[model samples]
Target: MQLPMKTNRITITKITADDLEAYEKLISFPQIAEGAGFNLISNKQMLGELAKRQIANDNTFGIRVHDQLVGAILLYEQIGQCGFPDEANLEISYFLDPELWNQGLMTEALEKLVEVFKQTSEVRTFNAEVFVDNVSSKALLGQVGFQQVSTVIDPLVGRKKLIYKLEL
Candidate 1:
C-alpha cells in the first residue's frame, strides 16, 4: 500500500529492488549500523544480497523525501519459524540518513505508519526495540504513544535494548 506523504515534500512507499543503493548507504553508516545492532555492510555484493532478501519480504517499506530515498521501516511478521499474532503483533525497525537527524522526519513517518496500521484489521499492536542509548528514537517512540515494556540484553549487539509497545 502507498502511504500518504507525511510532508508535502516527502513520500512513503513500499520497498522495491530499485532502492538497493539507497538502502546500502543508509545501513552502511557506522552510527546507523551500530545503533541497529548489526554488522556494517563491507561491499556492494553484500548489500546486493541483503537487499534481495529484504525486497522479497512482504513487510518492508521505503521512506523517501522529495523523490530521494532517505530510509526504511520494517514490520516483522514472525520470529524465526514460529508463528505469533499473525499481523496483530508487529515489530517495527527503521533508520534514517544521519543527516536527517533531529528534523522530525522519522516521527512524521512513524505517525503516518500508525495512521495506516489503524486501518488494517489484523494489526492490534505495534512494537519496537530502541537501543538503550538511542535517545532520539526513544523520544520519537514516546511521542507516538509507545510505552516502555522492558529492557533486554541483546546478545547479537552486546547492548541493552529497551522494548516499547503501542496498543492500537
Candidate 2:
C-alpha cells in the first residue's frame, strides 16, 4: 500500500526507470522468465519498452535488498481470470532473482505486501496462477496462505496451470 515497505531484509518500493537496468537483468534470467510464464526478450528496444511500462505502472513494485533491486511484483486486474474485476480483487504475479531462490526472501516480501494491503486497502482477495511444474511458486503461494482453487491449461503456453486465491 505504501512505497518503500520494509521488513527485516527486503524493502518493497516503486520500480522506476532508474532501476531499469537491474529490472531488465533480473527478468533476463531464463529460469525466472520461464517460471513467470514469459518469453525472454531478445530485442533491446522491445525489452526496454516493456521495462518502461512496468516502471510506469503504479501497482508494480521492486523487491530490494540493501537498496539493490533483486526482484519485482505486480498486482493488477485480469478481467477473465481468477476473480471478478473490481477494486476488491486483483491478480498477482512476481519474479525473483534466480540466484536468490530458496532463500525465503520472496516469502517475506510477499507476506509484507499482503499485510500492507490488508491493513491499508479495500482489497479483499488476491489471485495468482503458476505453471503446474513451478514447484517453488506453488510453495511460496501456499506458505503465504493461498489455496489452490483450480487447474487449467494455460491457453497461451499450453502448460497445465494452477490457480490460487488468498482471501483477506
Work out the TM-score per prediction. 0.88, 0.93
The count of residue-pair clashes in candidate 1 stands at 0
lDDT of 2 at 51: 81
Model 2, span 29-126: residue lDDT tens: 88876776446466878877888898899999999998999999998876646556576788999998988999999999999999999899988899
Candidate 2 segments whose C-alpha is farther than 4 A from its true place: 40-42, 80-85
C-alpha positional error of residue 51 in candidate 1 after TM-score superposition, expressed in Å = 2.1
lDDT to native, each model: 0.81, 0.88
Q: Give the C-alpha miss distance for residue 113 in model 2, angstroms.
A: 0.5
Give me candidate 2's TM-score against the actual structure.
0.93
Report the lDDT tens digits of candidate 1 across residue range 1-168: 555446655678877878777887788888887876446555668766877787668788788987888988888864434644466688899999999999988888888888877875468888899888889999999999999999999877678899999998
Off by over 4 Å in 1: 2-6, 40-44, 80-85
Best by lDDT: 2
